[model samples]
Target: MKHAVTVRNVEARPTAVVAATTTWREFPALWKPMLDEVWACLRAADIHRGCRNVMLYLDDTPRVEVGVELTQPCPLTGNVVSSSLPAGRVAMTVHYGSYAELGAAHDAVIAWCAKENLSRTGVRWEVYGPHDDDPAKVWTEICYQLS
Candidate 1:
């Protein structure tokens, strides 16, 4: 299938995230609880009042690292700790569907990057869109930096 790709420069912003490491097969079950816990924290702090979405950063190498954080402090979690990332150029794509389809989207992005002679650096991130709470309508923007 053809994939949609966009290129843009993004700035590093302070983000609160729950970090973990897991294998590809174990990710679903592990992620749910982590997000739920983070969500609860956000709700308790009333932070989701203005938040847009959460970011899921994926790192796969010798060990896998994953982090979920809010794009905005809406209300998904409370008492979030913010951290800054470096500014860089990135390739982006929006995937519209269930989380199950995310792997394919990721592959598409990687393929596109390969075809264009671009290399990825840092952990890949999936930016959850506004409707992150809903499975069917969840919009996630997947991004990988070019190196």
Candidate 2:
């Protein structure tokens, strides 16, 4: 399946994210608990503070490294935490489908970046949007900053 892609220049704002670094194969299993926690925190923070999307910023390292950062906290964590992502030019794309398909979306974005002669900087973030009861219906945005 193909989805429309958009490239935009975005500023990185400080956000409360539950971050975890792991290999590609281990990401899925590790992300579940962290994402669940992030959701709970967002719910507790109320609608206003709740994140509209989750971001996965891929780090530019030789080794295969991925960082999963939550836009909002899990309801259980009452603390309001925020981190600033350095502002820069980024290639943005929206993926509409099951969370499982997000990887493909990222691959597409990477390919797009290469085609445009753009290099990635720090970790690529998988930004998550509002809470969708069904994960399949959730809309996530994958953004990778240009190097």
Candidate 3:
């Protein structure tokens, strides 16, 4: 399916993430637990979340950072760490379907970047929106940093 791609500047956002190194096929299994861990930490720390769930991917090996955007950075330890999503130009596209179909949205953004002669910084992430009983109604924003 054709995707509507947009280019915009996004400000840096602070996040507390649980980092993991896993293959694409194992991502969901590993990340679900990590996401739960992150939320638990936030609750324990009494930190207010400012934005949606974000999963930053550094490569195809999929070094994943399961994170929740925070109003401010809070101290974290052990497997969970604090980081910021970089501020800069980005290529964005929304994926409207089940998580299983998200790869198409990623492909669309990468193709769009290539067509536009935009070089990517190899930092990409997905911002998850509200969940719906109907998978078709689910929304996720695929964002790629542009260089």
Query: How does each model score on TM-score?
Result: 0.75, 0.67, 0.86
lDDT of 3 by residue, 1-147 (tens): 677999999998888899888988898678888988888777777764555798998777888789777766566766789887778999999999889989899999999999999999899988898778999889998889998
Winning model by TM-score: 3
Q: Which ten residues in a row have the lowest lDDT in candidate 2?
A: 61-70
Over 1-147, each residue of candidate 1 has an lDDT whose tens digit, in order, gives 345987889887555555565676777677666566666676677655444345545456313322344455544334334544435898889888787888888888988898998888855676676665678677778888778
What local distance difference test score does each model get?
Answer: 0.64, 0.61, 0.85
lDDT per residue (tens digit) for residues 1-147 in model 2: 565556677776655555655665776576566655555666565734534445454453222222223344433353334555546777778788787787788888888888877877755666666667887677877777777
Clashing pairs for predicted structure model 3, backbone only: none
Candidate 3, after superposition: displacement of residue 26 in Å?
Answer: 3.6
Candidate 1: RMSD to truth: 3.7
| Reference-based lDDT, residue 80, model 1 | 36
Better of 1 and 3 by lDDT: 3
Error of 1 at 83 (Å): 3.1
By lDDT rank, best first, the candidates go 3, 1, 2
